[model samples]
Each structure stands twice: as C-alpha cells, then as structure tokens.
Target: MKNVTVVGLGKIGLPLAAIFANCGHFHVYGADINKLVVDQVNQGISHVNNEPGLDELVAKAHQKKSLEATINTAEAVSKSDIVVVIVPVLTRENGQINYQYIDSAVEEIAKGIKMGTLVTFETTLPAGDTRNRFGKTIEKISGLTMGKDFFLSYSPERVYSNRIIKDLSSYPKVVSGYNKRSLELATDFYKKGLNCEILQVSTLESAEFTKVAECVYRDVNIALANELAIYANNLDINIMEVIKAANSEPYSNIHLPGVGVGGHCIPVYPYFFINNGMHEGLTTLSRKINDSMAEYAVELIEEIIGSLKDKTILILGLSFRGNVKEPTKSSTLLLIEALKERETTVCVDDPLFNPDEISKYGVIPFSNQLADQIDAIILQAYHDEYQKIDFSVFENCSLILDGRNVLNQREIENLGMKYLGIGIK
Candidate 1:
C-alpha cells in the first residue's frame, strides 16, 4: 500500500497512522470528524496524550512529511489505496453494539474510494457485520460491489492503549478478507512494517469472530475468578494465594479478582456476542458478576466501617486499570458515585490523571488535608506508582480496603492500621 487513509484518529487510529508513516511503508492520511484532532495532527501535535511514546511518533511522522490529517474523509479516500477504519464501536443502551461511526466512515470511503481499494475495518464487531452489513451499505451508497469493484477486510486492532506502539509491532496481527486477492493484499501490507507474525484466516467473518471470542474468553475467566473470590471470602480463604498455588499445576491459570473489570475491551466486548444469541445466558451472567464486583467492594467496605456518613475516604488511582490514563468504563467511576450517595467525603489520587481533570467525575481531588483526615483509603487501581509507595504512611485511616490486593496487610497492621483486602473475610 503506497498511500493509506486511517479514519477515526483517536486512541487506536492515531498510533496506527503514526506506525505506517514512521516505518516509511505508507504515506498516511488521517481523517477524523473532530476538528481539534485534525488540526493538532496537521500541526505535528498530539491531540491525545497518555499513550507512551505516541507524541514522539506523531512528531516524527509529521517531520518526515509522511503523515497528514483532515476532517474530510472523501479527500483522504480519494488519495489512498487502503482505507483503514479504526473507529470505536460502542455498546448501546439496550445491550447492542452500535456501528454508527463505522457505517458513516464506510459511506464516506465509498464516496471517493477507487476500484480495488481494500477497506479493512480494524474495529471489533460481532460476527458477519463487516461482510454482510458494511459491505452492503458501501455497495448501495457507492454503486460498487464487494470483491468486484472494491474489497473488504477485517483485521481487528488488537493493540492496547498505553502499549499500542509495542503491541502493534510485536503481537501477531490477524487479517482476513472478502476474497483471496484482498486477503493477500492486506497480509502483505501488514508484513511490510509490523515485523510480527501475520495470521491470515478464511473469511472476514472469521477474523471478526476471532477478536470477539478472545475478549469474551477473558471476561468469562475473570468472572469465574471473581465468583471464586467471593466464595473464598465467605469461607475465610484468600483467593489470590489459592490462585498462586493452583497455577503450580501448569493447567490452572486463574486470573486475579479486582474491584471490577474495566477498560474498552473486557467490559464491552462480550455484549457483541451476548446480544447476538451466542450463549447469551452465560455471557450476560458473567458480565453481571464482573460488573457487580465494584458494588461488592463498596458493600464490604461499608460493613467493615459501621457507617460511611461524613467519613472521609481517599481512593487511590483514577484510571480504570493500573498505570493507564484511560478512565472510560472504569468501575471506580461507579464506586465513586456509590460512595458519594452514601454521604462519604471521597477524594481520588492518580499519577496519570491530574486532580482538576479527575474532578470532572464530581469527586474531590486528593489533597494533603484530605489525606490527613482520611477515615479510610480504598486502593481501587494498582498503578505501579501506588505499588511503590509505603503502605504504612497512611497511619490515620482506620480501615484500608485493598481492592487490587496490592497492599501488604501484615505490614499495614504493624503500623496500627487495619487492612481489608477483597477475598479476605
């Protein structure tokens, strides 16, 4: 692919465009509906921060004159051979995945894309979405037929947020297409720059289903661990230690239970298949169990402390996951609201997000005064920075609820503080 157009220059798309440009494999044109993101890209500035080494890659891509951006999709599609769709497909209110952004992007691409252009969607979607829905939509709108006038492919973007650059280059990329011709083209393009294993599958639907299954599998496993954790808690046993011991058998690899599952993939991906009638009962149950972990943490904390009214609680780490700047779908968000409703004074501290930005969530930013007066501390996110801190310093808090099990309970107790971790009675 000589020229590439990356639509939706957000988390996944920004790094994608940069990678293509930085590797000198493709002259990348990024198209986003957001004017601010477009303007920042054109000016060699990063519109989104928090992705490590992304700023440098964007700057280099701009300096080399290998990358550019615009809000106009027609303009980019007209000058590109590969039209990569990297938009976010979010879950709707009624438990269905919304593909509005992807639909809009494909329509725009159809308006100006040349014959034989590969329109590869890297976004996660339910099985048969790319080939049946998107392909038909583009053909209807543009008077083009799939596998004849244009080609469609599904190569789900598997890279995580902060580790995108590394993951893109290292992790095996899965690609599939509408036809053999499109499959070869997509695989060849990825092979040129990624320097990682590229797995070519049979159909676009296969690739789409592959991504969905990967995320759903993790969600189910994590939910099992959480269920077991709750069971262990009732029996006065430590699930983490049990997980450690069980893993020595080499067949049992139980994941750790946390406050709740979060992030773009785990919390949302299962709904793609769940709402589509693929064992909806089990998937929905697992999702509910994982989702309820946050509420469970809050309930346990409230029980440990007689009443939370007027008591000051400090929450460590604002991001959904540890060390990530992403706050979307964070269980901590729910925890914060639940705590506030109980009339407890809550303050949050995270090295990733600033206090002012965190205040947008309607919680107090952590301060020394808040810390000094903190009646309890909830270690929700186990960021590496938080792990490095001495747990004994927060000597004032009577109760310490370690949500991620990052704290040393005995050590905290030695400082005359009570430590209450999840899965511990």
Candidate 2:
C-alpha cells in the first residue's frame, strides 16, 4: 500500500483520510495542529460537525493499521509517498485572499519531504499560484526542484460539507500537474481512492479554474435567485411556484433563493478569482448582490416588526446551511449581527450547533417554547428539528421568516402566523 499524509483535518481532510483508509489501499496519516481534533481522531472519533460514520471509520482504520493521526506535520510528511495539503485560504475582511495558513502548511511539509515525494495542493486557490508561488517556495526550502527532483500538482477539493462522503465517492475528480509525470501519479492516486472518473487537465491553471468555475457558477445563479426574490416580493407573486412552473421545461434552470449564500465556497471563492489580479469587477458585483441578501432578510424582519421595537428576535440557525453546524463565514451570522445593530434582543436556536457557538456573536440561546416567547422568528437553517416544531408555538401574534424556503406556507399561515419567505410570500 502507498503511504499518504493529509494535512488540515477540518471538514475536508477528515473525510479524505477516512475514504483512503476504508479502501485499505493506502496507509493514510492525518495531521492537524488542533490538539482536540488529533486526540479525537486518535480515539477513532470525528470532530467534524456534519459527516456521518467518520468516528467509526477512523477507529477502524486505526485498528487495521491503515490510518494514523498526528499533531506533528514533519513526521507525517517524511513518511508519506504523497502529501496532500487541504488548508483554508479564506478571503479576509478587505476582500483579499489570505494565504498565511497555506504558506505555513507548505513550510512545515518542506522541512521533511525528500526527492520523489509528490506534493498535491487540494485547497481552492487562485490560478497559477501552485506552479508559480507554492511549488517554488517548497523547492527553495527543501533543496529540491519541482517536476525534476520532486512532483507537484493541484487538485482542489470539490465536495459540500453535508454530503461530503457521497460526493467524494461519486463526483468526478480533476487532476492537473506541473508536468506529465506529476499528472500521471496524482491521477493514479485519486483513481485508487475513488471509483469515479478522473479528468486530467493540461495545466495547473485549468484545474484551478475548474474548481473556481463551479462555485462562481453557483454564486451568479444564486444572485439571480435572490434578485428574483426581491422582484417577486414587489409584485406580490409567489416566486417559488413560478420557479416550479418554469422549471417544468427541462432547458430552464432555476436555483432556490435563501437568506444568503452561506458555507465556505460560494460566499468567499469569487474573491479568490477577483483580487488575485483577475478582473474581479463582475465577481465583486455578484458577491455584493449575494451579500445583500442577509440585509434584505433583516429588512423583511424589520418590516414585520414595524412598530414592535421592544420585541424579541429568535434566530433559528447560526450555521451557514442546514445539516452542518459549521458557522464559518455563514450569512446567517451576518443576519444575526444586523439584528443586533437594530437593538433587538436576539436568541439563536440550532440543534446542530452548541449554544456556546453564538457567544462570539453576542447572541443568547433560547429555551423551551421558543415559538411563544419571541415576537419574530427567523427560520434560518430549516433543520429537521425546526420542521418538527409546531407552528402553534408562535401562535401569539408574530411573524415567521423562512430563510431556507423549507416551510410549508399554507400550514404555517393556517396557525395565525404571518409567513414571509424568500422568493415566496
């Protein structure tokens, strides 16, 4: 079996490790600086918020001697035939891509890697960054030349948090290398791990753009959905029904509207394409329109509040999307911040997120009978628990704002609550 080391064990890294280990084709090693995560993985438990059966898989891999977890990067890198870096390169507040985490990860791997060790970057980054910057940095530090002494490639992770396992096993894998040999090795590695088809690109930029293209396509389409939501509101038309009818034609494609685009990719990735020296004006405009969705949701809540300034606001979810507890760069968090700016008391409820998750945002957790105590309820995530909640809980004269369009309008309105939904009134 080939040895592989995966860095950054947050949402993406853990599953990649589990998949490799489960197949019994590779001796997988996982490294993360977070001691808590390392300890949990060592015990065959997963700290990831949404992935299922991960804890068991980690334990099984460990028991079978196919997988190991570590807090040290050099040890993991030195022993592996290939090293996959899955670190986060998020877009900061200034609308620029930050590479501090990625740079540090490369430095750590460079310390112990030897000749013939394949370095594959799986993070979503700007075009030409791998071949131009990262590969050179590692070569300088390790006293090796990429494509000659060692190998380099870029294969961005393309799976959502909630459905990571299924997507990884089923989704097509894209591989691109600095040279022909690097591409062949990387393609072989992925093909061994996943049963899906692997598409080899001619250059690293093509592979990088492939990943960005997926998220940007979704961002622009969601922007159109949000735009339609506002237009439908003004016309007093149910946009959801209109979309369902329009979608009846197979050629017509319509995305659902939400409070905003949350999760890690759609909200921040377009900036990677933009601020990294690409003409980001169009993407910048798309991001702005998508970002405004949260504020638009807050405005709807304010209109619902009209004259009730002293009333309570209950935010139903803090995570960006449902079925996953990760709140990193979530638009729901933005809405909560906006509500605080309005001087309204906010209480957040999410079955997936621990109550302490909102402490950083200065929002309190709600108790029993959340529906009866709050004057306005913002159904942010549409978790299964939220659906199980009786609409009568908010029977005492309040408004329910369904951000995810997961609520049944007639059922909610029949309970004497005014229902307002994105793209659906």
lDDT score for candidate 1 against the true structure: 0.86
What's the distance in Å from true for residue 230, model 1?
1.5
Q: Residue 221 CA error for candidate 2 (Å)? A: 0.4
Tens digit of lDDT per residue, candidate 1, span 1-425? 39999999998899989888888688999999999999999989987767888899999999999999999998899888988899888886577777788878888988978887889989998899898888898889888889888888899888887789889988899999899888988898788757689988998889999998989888888899899999999999988889899989988888888888887888899988887876557788899998888778888888878788998888898888887778878888878877888898888888888778989988899866556688888888888887677655565688888888878888778777777777964
Which runs in model 2 stand beyond 4 Å of their true positions? Answer: 278-280, 369-371, 395-397
Q: Relative to the unseen true structure, what is the C-alpha lDDT of residue 337 in candidate 1, on a scale of 0 to 100?
A: 79
True-structure RMSD for candidate 1: 1.9
User: Model 1: which residue pairs collide?
Assistant: none
RMSD in Å for all candidates: 1.9, 1.6
| Residue-level lDDT tens digits of model 2 in 1-425 | 78899998888999898888888689988988899998888888888865776667777887887878898998899999999999898878886888899899888899879879998999998888998889989889999999998899999789887788888877889999999999999998888887678988999999998899888888988888889889999899988988889889999787988888887788888877777676656677778888888788888877766843567888888878877877877877788777777777788887876667666678878777665668888888877687688767665646889988888888878877788999777
Total backbone collisions, model 2: 0
Superposition error at 162 for model 2 (Å): 2.2
